[model samples]
Target chain A: MVLLACGTAMAQLPIYNVGRAPTEAELHPSDGVVGSDGKELPPGRGTAKEGETIYAAKCAACHGKNGEGIYPWPRLVGGIGTLNTPIPVQTVGSYSPYATTIWDYIQRAMPPFPLEKNLTPDNIYALTALLLYWNGIIKEIDVMDKNSLPEVQMPNRHGFYPDPPQSTPNKDGTWQPYWNQAKPAAK
Target chain B: MNSKMSDRRGFLKGTAAMAGLAVGAIPFANGNALASVTPGEPNTSMGVTKLGVTPDEPNIQDLLYGGRSRYETTVRIPSVGWNGATGLRNLTPLQDSIGVITPSSYHYLVQHDMHITNIDPRQHTLMIYGMVDRPLVFTMEELKRLPSVSRIHFLECTGNSGLMHYKSMLHDQKLGRADLTVIQAMHGRVSTSEWTGVPLSLLLKGAGVQKQASWLVAEGADLCRHAKSFPLAKAMDDVIVAYGQNGEALRREQGYPLRLVVPGWQGVNNVKYVKRIKLVDKPYYLGRETSSYTNLKPNGKASWYESQVGPKSLITYPSDAHHLPERGLYEISGLAWSGRGAISRVEVSTDGGRTWKDAQLQQPVFRKAFTRFRLGWNWSGAETVIMSRCTNEYGDIQPTMLELAKLWGDQVTPHYTGEEIEHWWETAAIMEFLNNPILPWRVKPDGSVQDALYNTLYNTNGPSKNSYYSGGKI
Candidate 1:
């Protein structure tokens, strides 16, 4: 019933002392990478019978024909265990994680940008082995090459942890405040 | 399986002939361009340097470089997207763009990580408690000291008709506006500006509201932390707590510094990387407001927490892959928003819905953000149906998801509305659905096709339960 509204701190001084104020990763830089363990990443391997011939010719136009995502496109298997419920249906082994970072994010970017022209790293290793064999992970005709595709293993890779890890640093010691389109409204 | 698909079509034709004989010199889609030069040459180059253009470089060593940090240290994600099974993806420009607010090398990302890459904003945090009165924890520089305001609004993507409902119930109006991509339907995840911050009723009046708090939760950091809950009188009317948008700061894929906008609502009630914000008075079927944004008819019962996003209309300069050049007086611009307020007019319909005019509305039209309405028409180009029909300021007029799933029976999940409904998607049926039995006393009240395919009336977001309880003044 009241409103008087009010709403930063990015400090890193020392320039002989004239004017300095840019350094929270030079105003936001927390960008993502994930390695040190997943290592050099790309070599490759895939299956789901070469991912159902790479999802019937470049993902049946924008994810349909079973992978059932039609509106602005995105559904590759019945969302298993809807993430903590309340209208959630995010598909593919239900919320992804490392199959070598989903075959290096489908061989760097996907098919709808000036039309990426049917990605081939063996078509992102058969669409990440037919989306980890349609989220059942392996078998529909499993094959994936390249040293046995980093030994196939994926199940939401233990839900993920390193949320803020640059060896535990904050105070702008490796920036973090991203999820864009401004989302924190509702005190 | 038919000879391992004939030996995987002979190993994808020997790996597309050894990767087309190894890249054989780039140029696949239009390789180099200025559209075949001749628009009076600068012909091209013109790269390097921006910020309001023609020289404004406030210096980041003259705004970033080197082939721009190797296209900003590689992270691409595309491949015929919705291609990794849809939930928002697309953001590639390699090197950054450096402000006018957004310009992290062209902030064109749509998230739900289609295998997303690089978005690490310093250990993120957004968790304001519910029913309020004292749950503070700011950081993103105390969320920019708080108090900020700016609006341009246009978040679009109520799943933009997913690949044309397979060519129309409105029968694939070009596959229902071909999963729109005019930069993912007019600039991916829309952006306008000046958003400063602090005003979820001034951080719920600096944390203190507990009179049994009416629903407020917000959550999301991705990997499906996607949470939603709100209605403390729409977070004390006109909620914000933003953290800078157009004026700058807040761009790690849009939710930087801090993010929670809610303007008119929908983009899943504007929640993302919002650590937590609990206050519960009720309603939490979760998993996206209950079984995938609800809407499952042929009757078995289910239409839960629909969430607002009503007054629709979208034409965007003859979009549908523009090519209109002819058609004379043609201005017909687009964009009209209204979660439930502002937009008092916008009708158009070229000749498809049998006569309707009134366009021009640019001036300073504000309220729930985006409001740019134009439309002059003339086009002797035949094949008409142009479209646009918004009408808010409380009178409500955008329904026709077939008339709100017949007033509510087929359990209308994609919730909310104003009713004039033109093409934000409402063909309601085009074919391939006889799954019948959505029987609310076998739908027939005079109209047909089982009462226009299961309408049977359900309407409850209010108007009952003693006018949604007490229904009076707070």
Candidate 2:
């Protein structure tokens, strides 16, 4: 039996994670942020030109000059429609949604290194404008600030909509939730 | 490659000195002779307890291991002083065609910040309070004294490799994408041990848990003080106050002394260095919860207090920077689990986004425990992408990183919990341009990972450049 199964892939199983059992949980897991206005929006802002400076100073090393990410690092630009395809997937102009998100990403976890020092509201805003200008979301001469920032609109903004509330009141107040959606239908 | 019993024994001596060649440290799990794995019927020839300990508890390297393919680099848990040696990393114990229990020292771990050396256990103490009859404090020994109840479980991090993205969002990513470090990854990180500890229900009973109590705040002793709140219902159901891991005193990195073990949930829920367990009525967005690990998206939103870990699957052997030999009967191995329930099915894809074949799942596919999956394939040796998709009992399919990122925003994953597989063979390489940036941090053979050394040379866009609003006026 052992030799017969020697070539079976499942037979070589070594590690495994159990089903979602109720175990002791952390008192403090990372308290990741989201803005009240659906913002990972950092407390920062910037313009396309200044963003260029910030991006060059902080992101250029890894993302390179054109935002065409490097080995294992991934290019930050293009590849918008590459999803579900053989073409390499990239981010920013081709993917991503809001300008606040770009700023938020930089504020939260970009640069890939030097750790969590936090970007300035100005530089963050600037970088968002720079990436936008590069992605053609905004023009090179556009001045990016809070009011224009929210209105700058992204290419893939149409890809998303507000998630239906996980727990919601049904049309008839039947409240057939997602968990119960497909169930009982089989009957 | 080794005997099951020896594997268990090795867990006991995880810190032992082996033959002076490679890591030389032979795990000494055999030393704990009379330690019986928490009573559930001994399920296999080798028994390793599952999810009843701290997240940092270093045990028999379980999870998925890579690197150290050379004798000089035999993986050994690296400490700061260890002469820059590689350490042990284990694989996820999936394939059920094998047995019930996971042998000690062969689970899986994906450590963060790569904690080395030890966090003095003697100084560790677990304290509990909030809406209780009496706030309680227990040393490691005090936790052991409570009636022990051991059961099989799995602890999966929601962010586990959400970084590696691909087409179908399953077996596309490479080997577990965190640490080559042992103390945290594999052997030293997540492990299945026959943990013998107090059922949290009993502890709540002793404290006279209040009727209105909703959540329990579990805090750790790590420098970060990793803390989080768990629902009370879960606490009583499968949670454990684990004092022993894999039939031995828990390792320092594994939250020695005492730690909270919440099975079938995200690993982040399992608090290590448990200094306090205060029952609260609401969830607090602590640092780890609000900032570091949660999934953020390109949109302005972060997913905080996400307690449920989604279904996920990853190929272990030929993952990440691997060379595919002319594939004929190549055994494909990986781990699969769910937060809502059991992993009912796992599908494999070989031709990048083309076709998929059902892979065999090992026996005794329990709920909330790592289910080993394997498949035999004849690789045409072409540059093809391979991926795995996991379907849990609830039928909540593991979404691709792209899909998930679209839905879940702000603190979304580049890797962590995002499910997608990008498998490419035939030696295709990352596109190179003049002075291409985006260099990743180099991981040292001695369990040390340098973040974006190359990334730094290219992109400087990180969090440090942002504004800081003093977490609340100090």
Candidate 3:
């Protein structure tokens, strides 16, 4: 087949600029992505107690009775201090570095099957709280919201160390590492 | 190979061989009726006639009358997969594959979920919004109108060769012969195709991307709405909002209508059935982005290792589980590819990794696409090991199994859970997620190439005492 590098040599312009301007209303619902700072989280509130009931009905079938994880389906609890072990069981309590990721995932793609079954903001919040509480990251009565969700510290929050930025080739074409790479100071 | 019989020139050659076989050689599984048609015989009832017959009997036409045909012999070898899902992917037949271009039909598929999306081109609309001056929505027809490009590139899954980490356990009785060809089963996940699509840069330019945008969160149209964030730098570089594969509309499994082709990156980042492109100042930290694809480091930390399909080459003809007919005068053929750039060279070694010789690369080696390489060798019937190594344009060389094991640090054990299970790998099973190690095929004295556990084993001890990372008497 004729292989033309798509955007290279941008000479002759505007062949098929046929898209319409999207309205704000059309963009909002699909646009919500709760950030690490909780900037875009939608109005929602749920307690771990409220989430336990929803977990049994909507999630337990695939995630296990108590978040132990069904086979093929991922395990969601336990393994809190196992990351450094030879056989690290990377469950939610032990591995997920961010709490916002948990909430965003349940809302966007959870229950696995039937694809995007829209979970209400409250349902998502409750499920997120239930998961955290079951993993011992949060208390049973702790209520989760847009403000509190991002504030919850995950066990592995400080476990990660950012990679040193990769260095480009030098002017003389010799390979070189990034100079004076910044390392976090020891406590 | 049903397609083989249909070709007039090839069929003539086949007829000579056919006379020696049993009557009515069935072509496909379940003994289909197509096999009943005898060679050199004209069957007007099925609208098929001999190659040189008159037009009166609806004979097969010449090359100008082009159309597609079904083939049974060219089939993927299947294996048990996640959840026994309906969306199970079959491995590509790399042994039979020739040249750089993988037929769209043979392109390996890896579905995250069970949904094989059937999106209507007319109904599908790609939305580009967030951190943009103009939020835009385009139909499939509209996107086709933009300045387009067709490129030859390879797409590979992050877990493409993950099974190689347990090569020793794979041959054990518990795992059995079923997992023997872990290379074929997993390596097939990487395939090259000529993809056609509009440049993602043009779409971003059309949206008037905001200066603050540092990431582009691409979303797919499937049920999971599978989403991932790509560095804005790469998005504006060589990315393509692709809709066609191998010169035609994409096959259903390859994301028909539209998808993102992030040249040279991990396949998961190339988001299939792509529907939205949202620009943001920071990464969205999507569930998949945060958890699944990260490389678990030996220090117990994780690194977001995406982009750049590692340098790898496999000797397909002399690969795992395949027996050689005879020892003398064999042309060793294989495929080598790199996400960094074009494959600069490929080296073959007949005596394990002790020595190496350069292989001839077939022409038309495009950047980020599979480069076919071949070398001729005459074996005198002595048992030996054969391996291949590749170096990309970026000067990155394929690492050995020993080196990769050290790099990833021996945490390679399999995490099997059932209480009734047996023979799980030892805890110190040092894993290499991107296993591009030099695979050594042991050719036995009988002219049959035997699949050996050399990668997992160090000394002459066999499979049971393999796992060199587990202190197995190396």
Q: Give the alpha-carbon lDDT of every model.
A: 0.44, 0.47, 0.67
Q: How do all the candidates rank in terms of DockQ, highest first?
A: 3, 2, 1
| TM-score of the second chain for every model | 0.28, 0.60, 0.79
Distance from true location, Cα of B431 in model 1, Å: 21
Q: Which residue pairs come into collision in candidate 3?
A: A6-B149, A16-B145, B410-B430, B412-B429, B412-B430
Better of 1 and 2 by DockQ: 2
Question: In angstroms, what RMSD does candidate 3 have relative to the true structure?
Answer: 8.6
| RMSD of candidates 1 onward, in order | 29.3, 19.0, 8.6
Relative to the unseen true structure, what is the C-alpha lDDT of residue A116 in candidate 1, on a scale of 0 to 100?
50
Considering summed lDDT, which 10 consecutive residues are worst modelled in model 1 chain A? A178-187
Q: Model 2 chain B, poorest ten-residue lDDT window?
A: B430-439
Better lDDT candidate (1, 3):
3
iRMSD computed for candidate 2: 17.0
Better of 2 and 3 by lDDT: 3
Across B50-88, the per-residue lDDT of candidate 1 in tens digits comes to 321233234466356423421122222231322223545
lDDT of 3 by residue, B108-177 (tens): 8866667688999999988888899778888888888778999999988766766423343343425443
